[model samples]
Target: MHPESEDDSLQRHRLHPSSLLFSFLGQAKQFFLPFLLLFFAAGDSWELWFALLIIPVLVFDTYRFLTMRYRFAPAELIVTGGVLTKNERHVPYARIQNIDLKQGPIQRLLEVAEVRIETASGAEPEAIFKVLSLSAVQRMRGRVFAERGEARPEDADEASAGRTEPAPRPELINSLGPKDLILLGLNPGRGMGVVAVLWGLAWQMGLFDGALNFESILKFFTGSEEGSVLGYSALALGFLVSLFLLSITWHFLRLFDYRLELRGDDFLSQGGLFTRHSTTIPRQRIQLISISESPLQRWMQRVSVKVETAGGTGQPAESRHWFAPLIHRHELQGILTTIDPHLQIEQASWQSLAPGYRYRMHKLSVIIALGIAAICQLIFWPWGWLSLIGLLPLFAWATQVESKYIAYARTGYGILFRNGAFWRQMSLTMNEKVQVVSQHQSPFDRGHRMASLRVDTAGAGQSGHKINVPYLPTARADELQADLVAAAGRGEFSW
Candidate 1:
């Protein structure tokens, strides 16, 4: 439904002054342990003075609780805080990118949701509305959308400009069921095994203790020598089994209560256990769509679909932002057609590497491996040679994979990068999202008429979204760079 005139429909709700007390209490709790430790570490006189100091803090908190004001206007939310500095924040409806509703265990017990509104300003500023009722949060969402003049997916357009009517709810085209959930769980793209292995390695490196506590358990299993061989073997077998089971269970539970509902132009996915999350990805916001399958997943006939959005969270250090874990590779086209009929799935002929390019790349890998081996030899002669030998085969295998798998496809709207060593990846990005494009040629590559094309996009965590086509013809790379720059200037972004 469209919003009425601001003068007629706009209303304001001020938060209860008591909220300040709760806020202060929450902040105080964060420092409670530290304060307690300090009190014990200090002498009785210092402890007594510190205890007395709490009186003024408490008095100030009480005063703030009785005077603070937080107002939610129909078109915007304003928070004016602090007794002295008077920090004021104004968040207008139009600028908000998304509203995130979060509830911790304590907040859940209190029947309150913390509303976090994310904006497009690169600073990542968020306005948090704490201890809000669920109904209130929903109402806020509706109001903000209304103020922004966003049409509901279900809305029907009128030929006559004067008349306005509410839009009917759209019909559900598809919904994920138990079978879909199971398939999603079984999807190889979830990389639970990889995650577990990484976890174990990190634990060994004393990084942090995560879901898999391998160190302590392994120590316990191998601590004694009386039945060391038998015990160690049993422990290893059990650990492997447990790891597999845990991965499966965690993957399954991740989508246990998963729900996807289509309402016009937007797709909404809601799922999670402890902290439920709902993501609304509008079709227009999607910059790229990729369907990828690792060797194992390809054998199992499964592929993962990844949709890259403009403002959503980026992938973790070594992970992907996938829409769904495991759909059969053959079914990806059908799924995309169902989601957006206009989306094109094209297979273009990929340019192959020149003979010299392949030879140079392989030589680089071999030299790097030998260099590492030489360094190792200086440190530990016999074992270092073995280490160098071990490194040789891995480098050789990597070189082979790089030669076989490195390819790219350019379509009318976007480019796709296909690469893999053992784990395959297909990354797609539209021409307009290419914020920067450049071509570079190494001396060796120049002799072969080959150059590397680099494409950069927004918000890819540390290094951002950079894709390099290693061995494309210099002319082709230059042409692509020009096209991407032109498209970006024209603002013709597409998914």
Candidate 2:
């Protein structure tokens, strides 16, 4: 490799020309909305001064784009931007999590991607350079990650001597079948969307709503009042058919060609149809891994996976999960084994929550029910009673079932916490990533001789970013807290 090229790798860099479009795109809402208002307000006057207002934004974008600069220094990456005020941010290699790139259709056309730098900080992304060439992003990623291909020849022999067979290029961890993708798309954004739609239809059909005179509609469909039975049956059949078709269509669009693979030491997910997305997640940087499933998925024996890295709580939907897009419950363990072999993900084997745990959840559920019912009562008396009476049993039942599965487990490197009933969420957090472990005991918990442990990590939510294992035997909770604190201390502190 040429010395000049190696030096150029660390040299100051500028974003691609398309960055101007990116600035406009980022502030498009601000610019276009005002422009739209002007157009609506000043109809004819808009044409006269359209360029006057628009040209300034374009000129500012160009100016800011030209001034923006980034450089990879020996110890850190520095990004400088802004027009009037010079904004500078220095991110050290140790603090950096993943240097990611995202591409849309326009970005793909220009062969450029939005480069985002996520560090240990779980707030805003440290730096983002819009519309940089994919090659440049990869180069920056490589440099930040391992300083790949930039080592001196004197060190090359030393590094090469220890390495073997190029470490076998990353292979597919799991591949989605036709049925898998279909079932995945079935859940789409909401697991019960189709059911809700069908329920709405049934309500409109006078099955739930008495206002809709189905008998009249039956007379129109058939001939006499006797045809009401046939009409209801036919309508029910039509609803089922419509539900089936809608589920298939929704599933098709969301999870087409979904595949999760392990590339080198990174997790790569490639999926989507209209708007394609390929996300690369660094294995070591992952702070939390969650496996979730709905009632439909459970019946189909499938589960979805989500991995949260050190930084950026608000990630795009497509880039959410590492595996959970329609993986079978049986196959989930095996797929996860590739990433964490020592960790046990078996649902049946997890340590169940304390037996008295349900009562606490039940109490909480009742309070919530009362709160809702009271609010509804203010609107209408009958509706309030209906809300209370209707939801009380349902909430109690949900709490009962959810409390049954509330469990926690531990491995040498990681800790697991499971909760929820219909929408089960199982979180696996690395010991190293645990920032703090807090134990809380309410007056209720004290009476029951139980305590709750809340484990905090960087990738978890800012406020509620805690894995709460409630209703633990006080003695057991104390023992567990010691173990957790020791485990966290033993590992190198990672965010």
Candidate 3:
């Protein structure tokens, strides 16, 4: 009674019953927002239509529940079902890049979680278990890595039978408490939510076309003349207040009671308020680790660390990154020790780019800022001169930012990149994740005998998948590219 003795040698199993709840919710989401709008438009009359839609959603959920089936075959994981079209797939363990666990409000309420198994083929997950218990997820994770030569299958034998023997919760290596969560809520990066709200309002008001007057927005928020400092102060305070309330709600729901653990073979995380969750990630599946902080986080002396997998889509809330999202800066070393002793980023001496690197590094940002200043001057006349004053300092600040934070270093495993001024990021990647390394030279760069290194990896989004290190000596860029290419060849690889 062993798995993989033959190509199709295991029993088909249905997901947890809570999966039906998840499936139904997925269907309801399609029409939920529209229903809400209709409710506002037509009052209680929309309830009947909303209830009518529920019937179809229920039917679809039941149909999916009846058809969906997965099998734990040793060599490959198989998923098959479809009442009509007859869909089926076999994802070999060798191609199974990473497995991620996620939970939404409902799934958390039901005390079950979703498991996403990905292959390097694309951003879409290869196998999805909508709802499974913590014990079941641990068993499945064990089975997956067992096939990958990273764990043992007998550990999941209890899973083959129906039992709830939860795996031992590993000892805490690092964690975030209430105070840290509060600081995370107050972090400046969260202010983007308020900015996005204003931008959306402006777009709706036709401000993108230069139709709306800026003074009117100021008047709407603060009833005072443009010359009054109280008017500007009130407006800024209002936005910050809105940002605080929004961020507090979000961070509390997402990171309340957060904890990180290491169970020898993998790292595990569980957190949330109304909707709790448990996530497991095999150590070898990790492609990169990022340690970062926003201006506010830096000011508060805290950091957020994210773990990226080779198969990630890199979308917020959906990506498998951020296994440990936020913690005090001092605790970073304690957690790094669990992941890998060699990944002590604080100990690594990073080599900064040349002092003149900002000539190229700040080129795009300066262009954008100057363009905004020009538009303000054109539209607002004499008053626009004030904007140029602010823009000038910001433009000058870029060089200082580059001098302080922009740099890269070679590591024993791969390249380490440090970038960003306001939202600082430090990424350490292993050679195995690198797919290609290329050198590029711009006309201006060649004049300075400089070039940039572009690294392509599986763990990247369309934009960030290609890592760029700008303003390096041409000889150094060429030499580093050759060395990286050679190292990539020597390292283990998989699709």
Candidate with top TM-score is: 3
- Off by more than 4 A, model 1: 1-9, 15-25, 39-45, 48-82, 86-88, 109-111, 146-256, 290-295, 312-322, 334-340, 346-357, 371-381, 388-390, 442-444, 463-466, 492-495
**Which has the better TM-score: candidate 1, or candidate 2?**
2
Q: Which pairs in model 3 have colliding backbones?
A: none
User: What order do candidates take by lDDT, descending?
Assistant: 3, 2, 1
Candidate 1 Cα deviation (angstroms), residue 218:
7.0
State the lDDT of candidate 1 residue by residue for 15-122, as single tens digits: 433356467677588658767877788856556466565566777766654444455454566666666677778887666656666655556566566666766554
TM-scores for every candidate against the unseen true structure: 0.74, 0.77, 0.82
Question: Over 4 Å off in model 3, which ranges?
Answer: 1-9, 25-60, 133-135, 150-153, 156-158, 161-169, 190-228, 314-317, 358-369, 462-467
Highest lDDT against the true fold, candidate? 3
The deviation in Å at residue 464 for candidate 3 is 6.3
Q: What tens-digit string does per-residue lDDT give for candidate 2 at 1-495?
A: 445434643567899988888778867766677777777888876374863676777788888899899886655788888998998888886677666666777777888888777775545678888878866665565455543224444322222232322222668877667777667655544445666656764764458556666567667777776766678787767766676667776665555676776766667676655545566677766667778887888888878877776666565332244455667688777867777666566643578766777777889999999997886677565666677778899998898888778788866766788888677888887778888888899998899998988887766644322378888998888888899899889978744
Judge candidate 3 at residue 397 and give its lDDT: 89
lDDT accuracy of residue 428 in candidate 1: 68
lDDT of 2: 0.70
RMSD of every candidate to native, in Å, equals 6.0, 5.9, 4.7
Candidate 1 lDDT score at position 364: 86
